[model samples]
Target: MANTRSSLKRARQNVKRNTRNKIIRSNTKSTVRNIVDLVKTKAQDALDPQKIYSAYLL
Candidate 1:
C-alpha cells in the first residue's frame, strides 16, 4: 500500500523494530518475575544484597 519507495522502507523498518521491542519487553518481564520469586521464597535475612542490587540495575 506504500506509494513511495521511502514509505515502503519505513514500513519494513517498523516491522523490524516492533519484533525487536517485543523480545526486549518479554525478557524484562521475565527478569522481574524471577527477582520477585527469589525474594518471595527466601527470608529477609537470607536475601542477598548483591542479587537485589543487580536486579534493581536491570
Candidate 2:
C-alpha cells in the first residue's frame, strides 16, 4: 500500500497513461496490418502517393 499521497497520485497517473498508450499503439498496429493487406491485394489505389493514409503517417 502507498503510505504517502504523492505515491498514490503517481500510481493513478501511471495506470491512466499506460491504458492510453496501449490503445494508441494497438490502433497503429491494426491500421498498418490493414494497409499491408490492401497492398498484398495489388490495389493500385493503396499504392498511390496522393492518398492520405493515416497508417502511412503512423
Candidate 3:
C-alpha cells in the first residue's frame, strides 16, 4: 500500500503510463504485420512507393 500522498500519485501515474504504452505497442505490432502481409502478397513492381515510404515514416 502507498503510505504517502506522493507515492499514491506516482502509482496512479504508473498505471496510466502502462496502459498508454500497451496501446502503442499493440498498434506498432499490428502495423508491422500489415506491412509484412503487403510485401508478401504484392509483387515488387506492383507495390506502391507511397506505401513503402509511409511504412518507413511510421
**Using TM-score as the measure, which candidate wins?**
3
User: Model 2 scores what on Cα lDDT?
Assistant: 0.86
Model 1 lDDT tens row, 10-56 = 99999999999999999999999999988887866458798788888
Residues 1-58, candidate 3, lDDT per residue (tens digit)? 5569999889999999999999999999999999998888786745779888888899
Give the higher-lDDT candidate: 2 or 3: 3
The worst-scoring run of ten residues by lDDT in candidate 2 lies at 46-55
Candidate 1 regions with alpha-carbon error over 4 angstroms: 44-58
| Reference-based lDDT, each prediction | 0.89, 0.86, 0.89
What would the per-residue lDDT of candidate 2 be over residues 3-50, giving only the tens digit for each residue? 699998899999999999999999999999999997886677667676
> 13 in model 3: Cα distance from truth in Å?
0.4
Best of the two (2, 3) by TM-score: 3
RMSD of each: 10.2, 11.0, 10.2
lDDT of 2 at 47: 72
Backbone clash pairs for candidate 2 read: none
